[model samples]
Target: MGSLDLEVTVYSRHSSNYHSYKGNIGTVNDNILNQKFNAKEPYTVIHTDIAQVKLSNGQWGYVSAVIDEANQEIIGTVVSS
Candidate 1:
């Protein structure tokens, strides 16, 4: 292969170091919900989450939302670039 001027493609694998700085930055709270998802009132139980999304311009953005457990509706939302 060397004499014929041909070379094989080599691939490499890498480990993720995204959480390298995870060193007691915040306190872990107790599981108050304990798998209970039902809520009698609108504001009694709420859930929040942040998600990363790919935009149309090939950029990354974050979407944060708060949901009401009783009606399963999104009470608040925010988008950040």
Candidate 2:
């Protein structure tokens, strides 16, 4: 059978320096797919912002997350303002 195709529906953010991570829609989807394919568990890769900071109206910054692929861990996240 083909890998399970799913999507992350929700996610949560912890305070700065917090050492915990709850998987989101994307992670969940990958998991299903991994099982179906019987491949190594999936993990999250670092994300690079595609949109420019100036894209926001009147906003000087943005919020972004950095996820670790191993163990599905969240490494660091920053919210720009």
Candidate 3:
């Protein structure tokens, strides 16, 4: 099993200097092909992207996924309508 944590950061310029706030959105398991994803890995190592698709019911959908570079396998997936 692997871990893919999602975070959202807010930056406010109206403040005196600059204020930033970070919040945890959620986590995803990205263990694919028996490999764990880590930031310390080399470039082109682990990749993630969002794909938009048309639902069968004539609606728009967004699919987010994490891919493992070693085997080019999608480890985790999330879909939203």
Candidate 4:
């Protein structure tokens, strides 16, 4: 009879600094919703982000998107050059 052996390996990864913002001006309202999301409420958190993009005429522009955290859906979007 022959003996068989098997081994298993696992890998785990995590990041503590996943999101960040810099160069913010004074008097920034960091908690506009009164920490509503911490209460486990729906439609209480909204997130917005801006991205630099290229236009159709080869020009640089900006695009911003506002999303609802509860459903992860975009509520508003804007583009400008």
Q: Show how many residue pairs clash in every candidate, following the order shown.
A: 0, 4, 0, 0
- For each candidate, what is the lDDT? 0.79, 0.44, 0.63, 0.66
Model 1, global lDDT: 0.79
lDDT of 4 by residue, 27-64 (tens): 86676667655424556777799986555675558899
* Best of the two (1, 2) by TM-score: 1
Q: Ranking under TM-score, best-scoring first?
A: 1, 4, 3, 2
Better of 1 and 2 by lDDT: 1
- Mark the regions of model 4 whose C-alpha exceeds 4 Å error after superposition: 1-24, 30-40
The true-versus-predicted C-alpha distance at residue 58 of model 3, in Å, is 2.4
Please provide, for model 2 over 1-81, each residue's C-alpha lDDT reduced to its tens digit, 9 standing for 90 to 100.
136776432332322463435555353334434434222444533333322243336434565666545454556667656
Q: Where in model 2 is the C-alpha error above 4 Å?
A: 1-61
TM-score on alpha carbons, each prediction = 0.64, 0.28, 0.40, 0.51
User: Which residue pairs clash in candidate 4?
Assistant: none
Lowest-sum lDDT 10-residue window in model 1: 9-18
Give the range where candidate 2 is weakest over 10 consecutive residues by summed lDDT.
47-56
Better of 2 and 4 by TM-score: 4
CA lDDT, candidate 4, residue 59: 59
